[model samples]
Structures are given as structure tokens and as C-alpha cells.
Target: MTGRNDEGAGMAGGKSPTADTDVLVVGAGPAGLATALQAHAHGATVRVVDRREHRVRPSRAMMLHARALEGLRPLGVTEELLNRADTTPEARIHLGRRTVEARLGHADLPDTAFPHLTLVRQADVEDVLWQALHARGVPVDWGVEFRGLFHGLTAESGGVPALSEGPVHADLQDVHGGRGVHRSRFLAGCDGQSSTVRGLLGAQWRGGPYGVEAVMADLELDGSLDSGLLHVAVGQAGLVFLFALGEGATWRMLATRPAVPSPDARFGQLGPPVPAEEVARLVRESGLGAAVREVRWSAQIPLQHRIASTFGNDPIFLAGDAAHAHSPAGGQGMNNGILDALNLGWKLGFASTAGRPLPELLETYGQERRLAARRVLALTHVIFFGEASPHPAARLARNVLPLLAPALPMLLRQRWLTSKGIRLLAQPFVHYRNSVISRDGTPPAKAWPRPGARLPDASVSVDGKLVRLHELTSVPGIHLLLERDAEPVASAALRTLLPAEGQGPLLHVHRLTSHPGQGVVAVRPDGYVGFRCGETDPVQLRAWLRLVGAAPG
Candidate 1:
């Protein structure tokens, strides 16, 4: 398939007539692919380029939180992801001779369609996104390296500044030793921790590596351990996380040991395969109680927690590991990266195509996602440090788990505690209430979703057919959810608030048949409520629309 689609060039922020694509993504990893797919879904022409010649094959990240699934749902790949994923409804915490089984299904948090933890390989998720992009005739240019950014006048030399406004001019190198320039309206630095784009942008990565070395491998286990249960174990050395991964391997193993003496090792760097002896030692030290029969893939990773100084700098943006890297605690790395991509993806689609420089709209991408990353980083740091810290108190807690194992199941099974814990990990309720674009013109109600909150999924009748609230909002645009009113004038006026066709972000208006309240909730393109009011006051509704850069000037 071809890389560039000239058809959407006009609609895709073509201030520079010579631009090849709307967005130039510099990696084909999950974050990059999701960014490309999301931008393409929202009517932007995207080109994905990766320095690596082949797609990633290892089952690196082995779990997807509910929030990632919810974000991917709007992109139309959640169905395929669910089909290939293994849901672990129960986690078996091995505490010496005693085992504590805790349910993972979000039985207490019923607002979301994905109420359980989704376990799928990172490679599988990438393949699903790749197939989706391929189906749309968007080809990933493999073995293509992003050389630098230069002005169109001096395309051969890297003279252009990274923060230069207007269209971006990027120098690219193909697999065949050919060098050329590919221009786009925007650039996404999803290239990972050692990001060249971030380097070019001079973004400071602030944080240091954790004092723990982790090893992950997909292997066949020769034990009586049940495949359906997520097995977790923590010892004085560190922790072990084992899950059944059915594609090409029976189980995926991730264990952390004391950091070895490696002065040159950096966080987010993947080292060569660990020796069999080391792998055995890792399992033994972590008290996983499993014998590795076969090793399919293995990598040594130095754990670290770092967040970039900035997420976006005008025309240049960063996502995934390029923006933040943290310990693999609570399976938050890949899931957080996907969320970052989805959050920035739709905003990029809106700003790049809005035909005018919406600095306010573009600024919120950094404001919202940076704060989200900071929260994830802080959470993962606490969890990882608590799990792997060599401190005496942490070790004492690990040593005492066996004595408390008898009561742990009952405590973990409590809906109130489990729901709060899962919500913290799943992050479905992450809101942007403080964002400039989010506004609440009505008093906060206890039963209704407020501005900046995630649009909760509910079954509502559409033309006498029951459909999910998300299913209706899945169409690429801002969704205005209005309560069905006997007088249609309010909803009618709200519909007229959308920008003229092709002038701003696409907007979809839907009347909720099951909504008992008399307010309207305007869901942003990224599925967060941007505005909510008791009634559809045109002045307030139009003001919110304009704030999000979805209204014609």
C-alpha cells in the first residue's frame, strides 16, 4: 500500500501545499500506530515511519487496562483486541504455603463496558492496529529513519528549528540508502525513550533509574499452576508477575531482582537475552514456584521513572515512552502510552485541520496529557518501590504476607476496597476538569456525569434499538449527548452550534432516550465530557464549542 493519501491533503491542514502527509509519526510501536490510526480516523492523512525494518515480535507488554481498551474502542480495534485477549478474572497471590485469590473483574465498577483486565501481547495489539491501518491503505514505511527537520527551502540541511510553527519539514532516510524530505503539518515523537525527535526538540527527561533490574520472558512452564489465574509473588529480592499468554507461549514471566552492577545501563534500554541460569535465579529469588521449560523470548530491562519536561512543543509532540518512562507496575506502561496517544491524537487531528492556528486548543494536549502522565508516573513509582524496594520495612511486609494470607482473600474480595483499587489502576475516571476547554455551566449532580469526566457508557435506545453511548460517539467527532425533551428547540439550537462542514472538527449530536435528566453533556472527540449544562443554552454551549476549537470563527 502507498504511504501518502493525497485525497485528504486539502482537509488535513495543507497550509504548505508541498506537504506530503498531515501527520508524520516516527515510530510504529503501539503508541505511534494508535496515533496514526486515530488521526486517520478523524480525517487526517498520517504517515508512520520506523527505523526498525520489521514489526516487533515479542510479547513484551502482556496486559491492557480497561482505560486503554476504552480509548481503543473508538478507533474500532477494541473488538479484535478483546477477541485475542485473555481475561484474568482472578489473581492468585502466592504467599509461601498460603495463596490468596483476589478477583480482578471490576464487579463494583460497572460504568464501563470493559470491566475486567485485558491481557494481550504488545505485539498482538500492534498487529491489530497495523491491520487496521493497512485496511485503510496506510502503509508503514519500514526501515525509514527520521534524520532531522529542515525548512523546505533548505531541505538537504537540518536548519529548521524543532519548534518552528506552521508545517513541519522532516528529513527521512529509507531502507535503500535514499535520502529525501517528507513534509507534514505535524510531527509525533512516539520513537520511545531515547527519542530523536525529543532530542531535537531539546526536551529534558527528568528522573532517574530505579535501583532494580527486571527480566521478562515468554516461556513454557512445567508446573501445576493454573493457566487462567494471574500468579503474583513478592519476596525479599523483588516481585514476580506471571500470566498466561496463549500466542506462541504458555506463560509470560516478569521478575525483578536487585540491580546488578552496570554503570552504562540506562532506563528503557532493552538488553540481550538473559542467560538460562539468570532466568532460573530470577524465578527462584522472586519465589514464583515455577520451573521454566522453554524460553521463547527474554530481555533485560533496567527499570526507571522519568517524565519529559514537556509533552508538546507546538508543531512537535511526544507520546508513549518518548514522553514518559516508568516502572512496569500495575501493567501501566503500554496502557498509559496508548492513552497518551489517543489523548493527543484527536487534538492533533483537530488542530492540524482547523485551518487556523488554535494555540489554545493545542496547548490543552500538553496540559491534559502531561498531568495524566505525571499521575501515572507517581502511581507506578509508589507501586514499584513498594514491591521491589530493598528497604527493611518493604521486606518486612513481604515477609508478613504469609501470616496475613488467610485474611487477605476476604479483605481483597470486598467490593468497596477492590473497586477503589481497580479504579486507581484502570484510570477510567481520569478527568480534565481543570482543563481550559472543560466547563460545567450547571450545578454538579450526584447522578450525572460532570464536565471533564469520562463519558460513562450506558445502554440507550436509538430509533427503538438499544445501543451503547460509546457506540454512538464512536463516530469520529465531538458528540453532544442531549436528553430527549418534549420540546426539541434546545437540542435543535445545540446542533446548530457545530462549525460549518469542513471548517472545524466533526461534531455529532445524539438525543439520549434513556437519560432522565434535563441536561446536555458534550463529549469531546477523545471521549471526555467537555461541557455540561442543565439546559442547552446557546451562549454557553457555543462558548464551550469555541473553546475546544470546534466552532467556526
Candidate 2:
């Protein structure tokens, strides 16, 4: 651990160097690179290493939820991502010829900057993150693979283990030629599910496979159609999804039967080839047969859900698929991983620069994210197999709900389903209640979701620009304070609590006069509001700052 250095001296852009960075981030996927970028911004020297010689494979995680957009906003790439991708605001779930077009954009829900999920290729998202990281002075070492980890305990004057300082070693295998050893104060594993870091740490990944397989293909369509809707057809043939990819392309697909083996076994079968004729038939059923003339990419993937037993072990930690693997039913895989990176990035940066033991802050990573992953698994089950009810009464309600869709107001309300579905699909809304990192307090008991809850999306103005509440709080490694009027004194006091230099565990203070009941609240980098204080409790504010290891006045 070391103090923050403001000097922007390190490898950035395309400059390659053989130097030791403060942090070694393995895996340049959404999770790894994001961790690297945020850590670098916080003023820590970062070196990102990835096993792949080239960019990540252009497969998986095509659906970018609204919350993910919120996370990207601070990274300064939300608009770029939207430009590179298409969107589907509504989705139709066809159950045995009984088509139910669920309006995902519900009217009652508060509007967001990114109201609907954006559909973009995985490669594009990674490309943007890579470029952003490079521009900020952290570059990834592509084609370098993480082999194993070396751990040695630091001893005090006596023969006792010194928790604060230790030498951690990493064995790396370069794709081009030689083998090398890298040392760092901390390490992050953004590698996929079969993580070498997790293996070396001997962390347990618990959860079984859903036993479903799927064939996926990315293609360009020929005719005109609303590229704003995702179509899920569940007929006698099986379940298939037609996602709109930008540039008049559609992702035509199918959901296979659940596998009988463990989660790992199921993931092994992803990306098998499918016949072009069958793909054409699926397109025809979705009314896109004439529009689709070419298949750009195709593969098969298994649907499995699981979370690592622990998110980290001392200096080494996990994020993205490395920490948790889940069913792609709701397109939640990448979203979960990115959120993990967002949560861990600032904490790691803060701990490293402050000279604190990594374990003190690292323990919270799993406590918060594992809960989210589990909840996501539950929601996926509800959407995929949660029975509305086989009872005659319940059956009638299910059938009648769709028939009433034509009404003027009802049609508009149906849009809420998409928002709700997206809420369920993306687990950002889960609050950290029981976790050690979260404060112990109850919100109003009658609140529908309860207190210590994720504050829902609301309309607000940022620097005179109207923006979604979620968008106002996306910068990573920052503690955001939303208030009604200028509190320069409070802002200065908060700044004094931060480290002298380094990217910031960023501390953002805003005044929201428009929303009256909303008082002084502190949101963590992962977008979780950690502390909510009324204008009255100055003492509690100081206590929270100290609890989070921030500087004291």
C-alpha cells in the first residue's frame, strides 16, 4: 500500500512498458478493464493483462440494462455505446401460440436517462472501455494469461503474521513467447467463470445449472421492421429470442433444454452451430424472414447460474464472470460483472492508496455482490419457470390480462412491465442491508420495498440539465451527496476527508432543491447509497465517513 501520487506518470495510451504497477488487473473484459480504469483514475498505477491475444469474442451479453447505462454514464461512454448499438423497448413472449406482447416500458415508473435497454454487441462495449482506459493512462496487456498466484506472509519483529504488508506473486504465461513473474500489492481476476485466480484461491462457486442450452446468431435483416422491439417466441418448436442489433441486424435465436449436469458442465456446451434453414424459419415466425438475408455470427451457450463462495482472498479478488456465472435468460451476465467491477474498483483504489490492509475493504465485495447475484438467479427463475399458476383461477387471470391490452390507458401501463422486467433482470436495485459495510437503520416501514433500499429512478436536474436520478450518480470511486441547495462548507469538509491525491474515490456533492424530501445522501461508487442523513445529523455524517475509512476533520 502507498500514498496517492498526483503525478500522471505511468504507461498510458499505446506505450508498452515492463514495470510494476500498484495493481495488476487480470482479464480485460468488462470487469477487468473497468477495475483497471477506475483504479488508475484513483491515482494508482494499473497494468491490465488479458489471456486473449486479440479482443474478446463477439458473443454474449447483448442486452444493456438501464442501470448498466447509469454505470457507464460516469465512465463517459454512455452516448458512445448508444450510438454503436440498437434498442428494443418492447418484447413479446409467445407461449404456445398465445402471444403476449409485454410492454417493457411501464408508464408508472419514473423515467430514466436510458429508459430502455440498449442492444449492442459485446465487442463494442469492450472496445469502448479499452479505449477509455487507454486514454486515461491504463493499458491492457493483451495475450498475457494468468497462470497461478504466490502468497507469502509478512512477519513482525516476532514470528507473528503481519496482515498489513505481504509479498504476493503472480505467474503469467505470455502468448507470444516467454514466461514472467509480476508482483503487486493487490490483484483482481476478471477472467471468465473458470477463473485461474479463483482456482488458486480455492474459492468455492456454488449453484447448479438450469440445464438449458441455446443457439445464438448475429445477422443483418433485409426488410423494414421496428428495431425497437425484442421478440421471444415460445411455440411448440421451443423458445427463441429475436433481438434487434443496430445496422438493421437482428439476433435470431433459441433456448435449449436445461442440462442435467452441474453449472460448469452446462456452460461447456455454449456456441454450437445451427442450420441456416432453421434460423430462417425462426426469423419467418417472428415476421422477419423476408428481412433477414445474412447471418454474421452464430454460436451456442449453456444457461447456468452460480456465485463464488468468496469474492476475494487477501490481495486477490474476483469480478464479472469470475465471481459469478448466471443464466443468460435475462441477459444479466455482463451487467452483473460490470456492477461487480464498479463496486470493487473504488474500494480497492482507496485501500491501496491509504496503506490499509486489502482484506479490510475486500471483505465487503462478496458480501454485497453475492447477495445481488443470488437475487438475480431468483428473478431469472421467476421469468423462466416461475409458474403464474396452474390453478383454474390463476390461469384465467393470466389469459385475461393480455386480452385487456388494447385499452388506451392499459396499453400505456403495460410499458411498466419492461421497466420492472429490466429491474428484475439487472440486480442493481438490491440494497445492502445485512452486509457489514452497510449502516444499520430502517427506512419507513410502509415503503413498498422497505428502507436501506435502492432509491428508485426520479427526474432531476444536473447543472441545469434535466437528467435521470440514476445518471446523476454514475462516476466510479466517488461518494455522491445529493442536496437541495449549495452547501459549500459541507462540500469542503467532505473534500478534506478524502486522500490528498489519486483519482478520488470520487466525492461528488450536489444540491437537489427540486426534490424536497431528498436530503443529504452518500452513494457508494457501485451506485449503492450508503448513508442518508437529514440536515440535522451532523454527527452521523462524521461517523459514516470514519466508518468507511475516509479522512477525519
For each candidate, the alpha-carbon lDDT, in order, equals: 0.77, 0.63
Rate residue 93 of model 1 by lDDT: 89
- Candidate 2 regions off by >4 Å? 1-17, 87-108, 151-164, 219-229, 246-251, 257-272, 275-296, 386-413, 440-452, 457-477, 480-489, 502-505, 511-519, 535-539
| Model 1 segments more than 4 A misplaced | 1-19, 152-165, 246-248, 261-263, 442-447, 459-467, 490-505, 516-518
lDDT of 1 by residue, 264-380 (tens): 875676777898777877776656667878887788988778999988767889999999998888889898889888888887777665667777877888898899889888888
Tens-place lDDT digits, model 2, residues 1-553: 1101221222333233357777898888888877886676665778888777666565566778876777667777788888887653577654443445566544234545666666777778888888888687675776677767544522112211222366456666665455566777778988887787777667788886554555677777676544567766543333567766532345545444334454335362345566777566666754333455787666666655677888875677888888887666667778878878877777777676765554545687778777887787677655555222233553455455445445534454565654665655556556776655555323321211222456566777766778766666766555555555534466656656666653354566676656554346766665666666545144666666555555442
Output the worst ten-in-a-row residue range by lDDT, candidate 1: 7-16
Error of 2 at 540 (Å): 3.8
Clashes per model (N, Cα, C within 3 A): 0, 26
Lowest-lDDT window of 10 residues in candidate 2?
Answer: 1-10
**Best-matching candidate per lDDT:** 1
